[model samples]
Target: MKARSKRLMLVGGGVALLVAAVALVLSAFQQNLVFFHTPSEVAEGKAPTGKTFRVGGMVEDGSIKREADGLTVSFVITDTAKVIPVSYRGTLPDLFKEGKGAVVQGKLEADGTFRASEVLAKHDENYMPPEAAHAVEQASKAAATVSQ
Candidate 1:
């Protein structure tokens, strides 16, 4: 083959390889990425069942129950309009408590409960995830408007 033609072929192959590598990297990133959803979103069927995701909401008052085994803990998460029951087995964060915001990452069990692999409690009394707080505000406003 001519030297010029060989050079062109090499350049084309390099470009193709670069494109393939980029595509592979993007695919892997997408597969590993987890998104945050609200408990109401899960109850409304916006979250994918059986797929792992982070759920942000307030821990419902009086909803936490520790099992007899001492390791299992169950609680309800609420975004005002909906609620999702979550079960977890592990030590909880120091800030975890009823009426406080939390984010739990896990998959939905077949029985409709969330099997949380990890839980994140809000940092302070006033701290809330921006998205979850917005959702709660919207829900309250919607309710107030409807009552009129």
Candidate 2:
């Protein structure tokens, strides 16, 4: 083959390889990406079922319950406009409590309960996750609008 033709072929091969690599990276990102949702979103059936994602909201008052085994706990997370029941089978964070902000990573069950694999509580008295805060604010605004 002519040198010029060989060089062009080599360049085309390199571009194809680069395109394939980029496609693979984007596919991985699409599979691994987890989205955050509020309790209202979950309640409205907007959250995906049987997929790992995050749900953030306040731990509803008087909604926590511990099983006799002591390792399983159930609680309700709420955005004041809606609530989702979450079941976790592990130790909870020290900062976790009712009426405080939390983010739970898990999959939604067929029965509408969230099966949590991990739970994260707000770290400080004055700090809430930005997603959780925004969810709460939006819920409050929605409630206000409904009441008027």
Candidate 3:
């Protein structure tokens, strides 16, 4: 082959390998990606089942339950339009409380319960994840629409 042809082949092969490497990295990142969903989304069947994800909302008033195992805690998470029961087997954050915004990372069970592996409460009265804030805004709008 001509020297020019050989150089072109080498350049083309290098570019192809770079592209393949990038694609592989992106695919791996996508596989491990977890998304945030509100209780309303889960109720509407938009949340992923079987795979672990996140759900953020306010803890339902009077829904916190302490299991016999003390470490196991269950509570209902709600975005006003819908609710999902969640169970966690660990300590809750100091800021975690009923009727406050919180985020839980876990998987949704077939029985409609959330099996949380981690629980994160809002840092303060004013701070919440943007997604959680949006969910709360949507919930209030839904409540208003229902009452109207």
Tell me the spans in candidate 3 whose CA falls farther than 4 Å from its real position: none
For model 2, residues 1-148, the per-residue Cα lDDT tens digits are 9999999999999999999999999999999999999999999989999999999999999999999999999999999999999999999999999999999999999999999999999999999999999999999999999999
Ranking by TM-score: 2, 1, 3
Quick one: best lDDT, which candidate?
2
For residues 88-120, write the lDDT of model 1, one tens digit per residue.
999999999999988899999878899999999
Model 1 CA lDDT for position 109:
84
**RMSD of candidates 1 onward, in order:** 1.6, 1.3, 1.8
Q: Is candidate 2 or 3 superior in lDDT?
A: 2
Deviation from truth (RMSD, Å), model 3:
1.8
Model 2 RMSD vs true structure: 1.3
Which one wins on TM-score? 2
Model 3 misses residue 11 by how many Å?
1.4
Q: Give the TM-score of candidate 3.
A: 0.88
| Per-residue error (Å), model 3, residue 4 | 2.4
Clash count list over all predictions: 0, 0, 0
The per-residue C-alpha lDDT of model 3 at residue 58 equals 88
